[model samples]
Target: MSDIISVGFIEAESDATKCFRQLQYQNCPRPGAEVEIIQLAFIILGLEWNVVDVEKEYGIPPDMGTQINSTHWTGMMGLLSEEKITMVLAIYKIFLDITPERMKSVLFAFPSRYFQTIYVVRKPNETVSQNFIMNAFPSTVWIILAATFMIIWLIHILHAIIFCPKDSSIKKVFYQESGKSLMQLISANLRQTSELNSTGSLFVLNFLYLLAMIVILTYYQTAMFSNLVAPSYYKIPFRNRNELSARLLEGKVFMTDIKRRRPYCAYQCGDLYKALEKNPMKVRNTDAEVFRDISNNGVFQSKLDVNFIPSQFNWFSKRYDKIIIKDNLEVTHYTAFAFAKSQRKLRKKFDQALLKLLPAVEQITTAHGYRTRRRPFNPIQERHFFALSIREHFFQVFLIYIIGISLAFIIFLVEIFVYSKTFKNIATFLRLKT
Candidate 1:
């Protein structure tokens, strides 16, 4: 037994020498010297008595002195370089001694330890967490949707202002008639010439321009309101129009009235419209006033002459008996993206990061009480602005066409007059020469 145990130090020393060579150390210690140092360290550590006792108890082999001496060098060297050796030993100790439960606890407690080390090695440039990068920043899909809509609206406005006939006529009218010095014949007739014909066309052009501007502005405002403003104001968590409409009809939640009178707990604006349709009440106030009345009255009550529905009610009623809360409503799903700054490389990185994290975010959100069936990324639904409606678009286009044709006619008339004046001047010059 003594002979067998005495050879352990020699094996340890051999392994150390092998490691040193593999690491390409400039000045490797001799195995015998390392073993001597290890033995001294073990003695200091109070293991000398245990080693001697173990040797005596194990067996008898007087020739084991040579093996023991050789092995001593390996153990001594390991003890001398205990700092690095201890770490490696500790890993093995943990693997052997640590229970599965305790290992789990350690891992949970120090999750960031491993993550940060790996992050440093793999992604030195990334300081932000994946969670923040994927969730906190705007998504690329959303940004694209927003930008696309903005560009389309901007082009529409530009087309109306620059190439639209209504705008062109206004410019022509101002250039030809407003700043010109008029002859007595023209000046006398100008006031009598029923300026309504020309002035009306100009007025129509101006109206179209104003209308176009209003439409563009209203569309932008509505988009912003649905996307950002309404969310902040209503605090409704519905993802799409259907959900929103259902929430409204549910009649439990109140739509926010920032300024108007507060409605009843059970009623909404939709209910009031229904009540009014069933029996038109002359509430001496304007539409705004009607809203005020409903806000003050918490419940809709049928009076002999007037029926009142609370402004807070969300139910829809087409007729007295035909009241149905709409379950389906139209909603738009817009895609957008976000980034920390305008970094070209980071944009791609961000996109890849988002793709990886999207599933995780969705899982987390679902766990946190978000409705899994509802699409949370859809844009909020609201009433479309009148100007942005299809009818308004067509009307504006027709008005522009009429204005363009009228302006062309006026320009032709001006050209004819200028030519006649030039011809007269030339004739007078020829007569004088003759």
Candidate 2:
């Protein structure tokens, strides 16, 4: 029998190796049958394959070399565990945990791909235009204006209370009573004036404050109540692992590290460390498990309602259609194949074959979904809507117009009902007299 290499793969599909399979696969004879490229790479190096799928491990205790354990082995800790697999061909394992014992046992290879932080946020139902702080500046500015108006309103109220007479009655006109004083002060705040008995500083302060309040309030109301239509752009709620961790802390999202729990940052990123510290429960999830196909139509797993991925994923992004992959790159690391340290000769042979084949092998065209995808970039399936222009503030304003018309019609009916009742009462009274 040919030397069969049992390669570990994170099944349920969300692992980084899904893209690795995309790199290896070519012809599929039927649906749901996958032919991986790593499998081909091993075959190219003259090795038979035993693809071992990593099973889900929820509510299980930590194994040796785990983050929870006393050993320094982090991430998956053991790719060659159970002695079933001769090598680990995909996934980046940082050399931080590679101790002298590990160095003697297993050989780590060079990284093939660059990885960065890409956030998978819940696909929002509305446009993201004016959603971020750029869009929220209006509210902040309005709050400032309201603060300024409040100061002015307070000044006017004081002028009405202290400078103005408390009693309006002729008998008590000279005496300052608290009741009428408070009433006048409150009334000035609403009517935009202060009826002070004096004319110098008190009048000036009251006039300036009341005038400023009225102007600002009028402007604020105009902005708030106008037929103004704002455009919305699409945005995911969370960005980085820390933000997702915040959501997890707040119970806005959930994380499942059921398959492989020991993800002590492959690159030991400080931000990821902080995020993990903030939310220990926001465990990492494999991409395949998180995103799975359910229908003939390429709909992702409906149960994937994660408000955030809640953890960092060491992956690349060349195309971003739905989940926004920002330009900010994190945890720079290389990817390479791994083998037992004893198999130096075999590893060298594998490397030699990779040198000749990778450039050509990687040039595979994008045709079928999931087969040719890489990292964060995947071809988005196209859907059609019959000529509805969504580029600007079109539908948003139209919705406002519809709502306004509906309110107007309702008021008109109410007015008609009241007028008809008045007329009916008058006619009945006249008829009774006659």
Candidate 3:
């Protein structure tokens, strides 16, 4: 009976002596099988392989029932896929004989790591391209606009300084002295005017100077009114802080306590009256009586006596007597937006967005009952109780001009009187000498 050979497996690097020992223990194959094992080792190591002439060359027995399998080859192929090995020599030797379809199948079965190497190999010129288009005209336009404004501003300043009454005060004084030098005149008059200090004269001079300023300012304001164009940007409707504070108190009627301090709040007297009436629970401090009197009287009555409460806890009410109490509240709307330099392509889109959003913003604000002014409060109507207040500035300027002309005439008369007296004295002395 033939002996059954059981193959023994060991680690790939096991020594030949170890293999022999294991084989001896197993009493595996006889001497002829040992020669076959040596031949199998040569075939597995790639030393030589010719299966067709195997019997002819070695005279080996046929069908020895020996089969050989190598796990090392399987592990090498797995490492190639995982490590993305793409050496040209390895490819030519291992994969050159493989069919194109079979090659593709093997490549597809690999993990993404193998494909990463394939992509780098195939597309050497691939890169990301970025496009940047910058529009610059809007900035240029703004620069031009700013320059134009500066030029116009310079011209207006020059005109105001050269022709405006306020700026010409010193020139007017110098011109009034006629041919006499100021120093000479002052020296001569020093003894005569000893009892009169320069302080009184200085005061009078300043008063006249301010009066001239008032006239010019009034004329400027009146001209703006008559033009109907209204210098919207330059015209500061309020004359001073007192008026501003008064209006702020008035806005307290509809505003929350916190809103009263806001820069844009109008604080009109009428609004203040209404606010006080609405919020009775709101504590009024020391100024409550004064606020009540102003609310009832529908007038600030006296600028000095005006009362102020903390905008948070206290508010001003609308005056019952004033038409604004029933009329549309006059408030100014100020709007601001960011603009890019000379960028016209996006200008329309940006403007459209603003127009769309502004209405919604206004709607939300209105829905919340936030009081916004339609236009600046008319000082004339409030102060004078008549449209005549609008023209008051014009009249005031005209009065100032009249006063100036009168003073000039009076000075002319004094010069004439002084000259006549000096000439008479000279003539009398000459006649006595002759």
Candidate 4:
């Protein structure tokens, strides 16, 4: 009986394990049937197999020790180097850094599916300014808009004075209340009914104001809708590594230890890996610990946390909707089985068998969900739009409606008080006259 080791670091086993497990259960495999690679490879070579899980024994995933000059090797790679096991069942490319020391120690075989490393971070929230309505447009645009209103008011005043009746009083012609005119002009701009009836220059000015108002309102509404839907690109503190690095320096954000581990970092991450290593405070021992901290911090503080994880379909589960998975930042890598250097003949034989069973292995990978599944960098999905209650979408509209209704009620009360006082005065005068 050949000893095939059960070696999976993460929650699930690699596609190879599924291929072998499938073969063991069924004599004649169905189309697209999943099989466990290592055990199936040995079984096809006419050998019985026993399984052992190294991760279970050590309470840690395997690491393909670093460099040629490194004295120590550990985990599944260490076991393979000493020829203690027949084969490491599910050694991923991430766990094995292809270095001179590692290459000399173990022979990689049965090249499996490719997967990518992705950086996940909390979606940036749109923090609306206190004066958001005014801030919607720049100072220049607001100034121009205000000037347009003033010009329209001035045009009306000029027309009223110049075209006044010769028999009319000065008070009726020149007594243009500036405040009332300004309010009416504003109402007209808002597409509301206003007392701005005029002709000639005043007419042309109103026409111009209407055109300008259309443009300004269109732009303002679009800008507001965009901001409400998603945070602007400039407002999003970090999008890529360069921006994240800047934020890190300012103490606005920090990266998790998920990708900072030596095996995972390799030569791909470069400076970022070095930065992570220097900061021990960023380390979270497990995935749950890392996720829990990020979830807790996200609820209370606006501090955006960055984490590197492999792209998988299951990531969408739990509180992961708030975590934005960046597709642009995806780094692809292929996975394969690792074997002892002494077992080159066995590796060659297994490789041949595994090649013949590649279709079956791929089917199992898909069935077991080992394929690369990514949630594209979409603001709506990251914000969990579908998960939100309907009330959230219309909250702003409802709030405005409530405020308007309250104001109308207050105005009604004030009118009642004023009318009641006038009626009482009239009745008293009538009684005194009688």
Candidate 5:
């Protein structure tokens, strides 16, 4: 009978509080990817195995080393280097970059699975209510509309000056006819009868202007209605590293596991790396702390926290509905098992076993909700579609309506002050009486 191989397993801190336990053999409701791979490896090798907690046993963390050359090995690497454990089970080779020191210290088995870094960011919620009308059309569309309005107004002014009955100065023409032209344009757009008495070219221009207004208003009204009914989709805050750095500058905390953080920012250069290094507190010590930060909208002093995590933990992003992921800045890596450099023969045999078991591991991973294709991140919440809350959905439209009413009231008061002959007559009568 083969001797029972003592294999050390690094327990994931995140799975500590999970109802579905990790690193379990019998009757485990949900054995994670690592445990699943270990179980398959043991079954294929036809060997009895004992699982040891490398982190709990040794004060060292699973994080091998941040700096390349180290006299001493720490964590699972230390245990493996000393041959305390036969081989560390599921020592993710991807977590730490494959440095020359690491390659020399440990034997990496055939890569078991592929993984990449994913940036999880909060969907931006802050939108300007005053921009509701402007946002109905894209910036380019609004610009075109404004340009068209100015052109039409200018043409009307030129036509009025050219066709005036009496000789008038440039200032007199603009003052006497500009107000009338603007009022006619406004009245025409509102489907009211335009008081524009024109004959030849001016008449044709007026007709074209009215037709253009019809088309413009048609599209504008359709867009406005759609905006009122449809769910509001905010642009993804940041997709690339540069944009992410800008967000970090805006007080958004960057979150990552304490163990894996060193490698992520190991480049020791670039704005992103520097930004990550600035926030030490963001490197969460415990899994519970990380989970809490992610779940609670990542609100650190009213700013959302951005998370940099492996694609494996993407389920956490899905779990917290508010969390959205951007894979544009993903760094792909092939992960493998780590063995002590002394155990070359064992490592070879383990590699052969793992090669055969990869297909099965993939199937198990998919079964455990780790799909090959990741779920797409959407800013629009699901509840927005099914449950139509007036306060949430109609707030912009309601605010716009209030603004229009307030503007009309202000205009009515302005008219009373500007052109109310009755008010002037009443004041004169009162003065005469006094």
Candidate 6:
């Protein structure tokens, strides 16, 4: 066993690096080194250790052998070139911008870990009623259906009104009955069939009425069932950067807030950064600003764009359902332990220790509880699990219920016109009670 070597670490406040700042540093000496999952392995491997505050001793750029902290893709290259620390404890890959210098400067220890990233989206500002109205009566399909039925009904009613035989009270009564029945059909209530008393067009009118109604009910039930059975989802999910750029060029979505945020990988990805910067997406600083555009109908407008985000933050934002990860736009950056050019033996020993501990570490941490493994990663989301509600799914059903109530009201109006005697009788009974 080598003597206690100085382990240097960078202190970052974000959730990604918070694990080292909290768990590992707490067990180590005062103002200890930043550590990662590999720390447990280092301890069990029987390696003596001394904590070195890299930030204070060497600075981020590392003045002497004191600093070993660099989280950037190329941070290790600069530190190793200067012979600051013998190895890097935690270096994350932003992208493989490797050059000849990196090739010669360091040896990589084994056990690279991967992370999952997702996009966060704002919620739509739609009420339950609005959602029902929007989903039930889709413009393109519903308008065409309503218009087609209206034209057919128009021809039927006009024959009774204008083209009826002159001096026929029966025809006049027929027109009134037909108009009232048609109104009920518009309100989407099909139980008014027994009230039809027109002679010639009775069978034809009933057939058309029921047929058009069947179409409407079929569509309504299908939509409601789809909403209830399958999970509610947006058809167009947020895709890769290229897809976003295309959407912007086509003016499908505009920026809402684009003040500087955390490191956006798109800046390193390609032309997407420039394209978006030309008309960068705007951002919402408050909840009201974020959801302002969502109130129009139930569909949330594509307002903000997240270029780079960790999965924990994305989950904590609770926008996973609305904004999805770019499944096809998988940009993975590799993270590896870094060792100095002369420390091949140490690097080889790290691989052996890692092989013995990584699987066990992952299992133990995961078994302790999900949060333990990802303790510092998504602290915000984990704490608020109790705040979740079924309303996220039930909003669709709630909207449908509101529609049903509105339809019932319209049907009530039609009933008063059709059954004038019953309403008058109720009024008289109410007066007697009063």
Candidate that would win on lDDT: 5
List the candidates ranked by TM-score, beginning with the highest: 5, 4, 6, 2, 3, 1
The better-scoring model by lDDT among 1 and 4 is 4
lDDT of each: 0.31, 0.45, 0.30, 0.54, 0.61, 0.50
For 1-434, candidate 4 gives per-residue lDDT tens digits of 14543333322434444443344356423212222455566668876655454555555554543433454467667667667676665433334434456666678875555444444555556443323345578899889877867777777666676777889875656555455667767776777776647666676777677767777788898875554555433134555544444555555656665444332333445555444455323655677766665554221111111112332211444555455443334344545677777778877887898887777664554444444433434343332232323455456556778998999899889867868988899999999999
Q: Which 10 residues in a row give candidate 1 its minimum summed lDDT?
A: 112-121
Full-model lDDT, candidate 4: 0.54
Q: Which 10 consecutive residues of model 6 have the lowest summed lDDT?
A: 296-305
- In model 5, where is the ten-residue run with the lowest total lDDT? 299-308
Q: What ranges in model 1 sit over 4 Å off? A: 1-311, 316-392, 423-434
Between candidates 3 and 6, name the one with more favorable lDDT: 6
Question: What is the TM-score of each predicted model, taking all chains together?
Answer: 0.16, 0.42, 0.19, 0.58, 0.69, 0.54
Candidate 2 ranges beyond 4 A from true positions: 1-103, 114-203, 214-228, 231-237, 257-334, 339-368, 372-434
Instruction: Give the clash count for each candidate.
Output: 25, 15, 32, 8, 0, 7
C-alpha lDDT of residue 28 in model 6: 30
TM-score of predicted structure 5: 0.69
- Say which prediction, candidate 1 or candidate 5, comes out ahead on TM-score: 5
User: Candidate 1's residue-wise lDDT over 25-92, tens digit each?
Assistant: 34334333223332333344333211221123333221112112422312222221221111111110
lDDT per residue for candidate 5 within 1-434, as digits (tens), equals: 22877777655534322322333354555545566687778789877776776666776665553433464576667777777888765432214344567777788888666654455444456342334456678999878877877888898788777776676687678777788888888877877788657888888988888888888778878876565556556555565556666666666655555444542432323877666566433556776776577554342211111112322222234454444343444444555677776779878888888888877765765556433334444555432344434676566678879998999999889979876898899999999999
lDDT of 4 at 409: 100
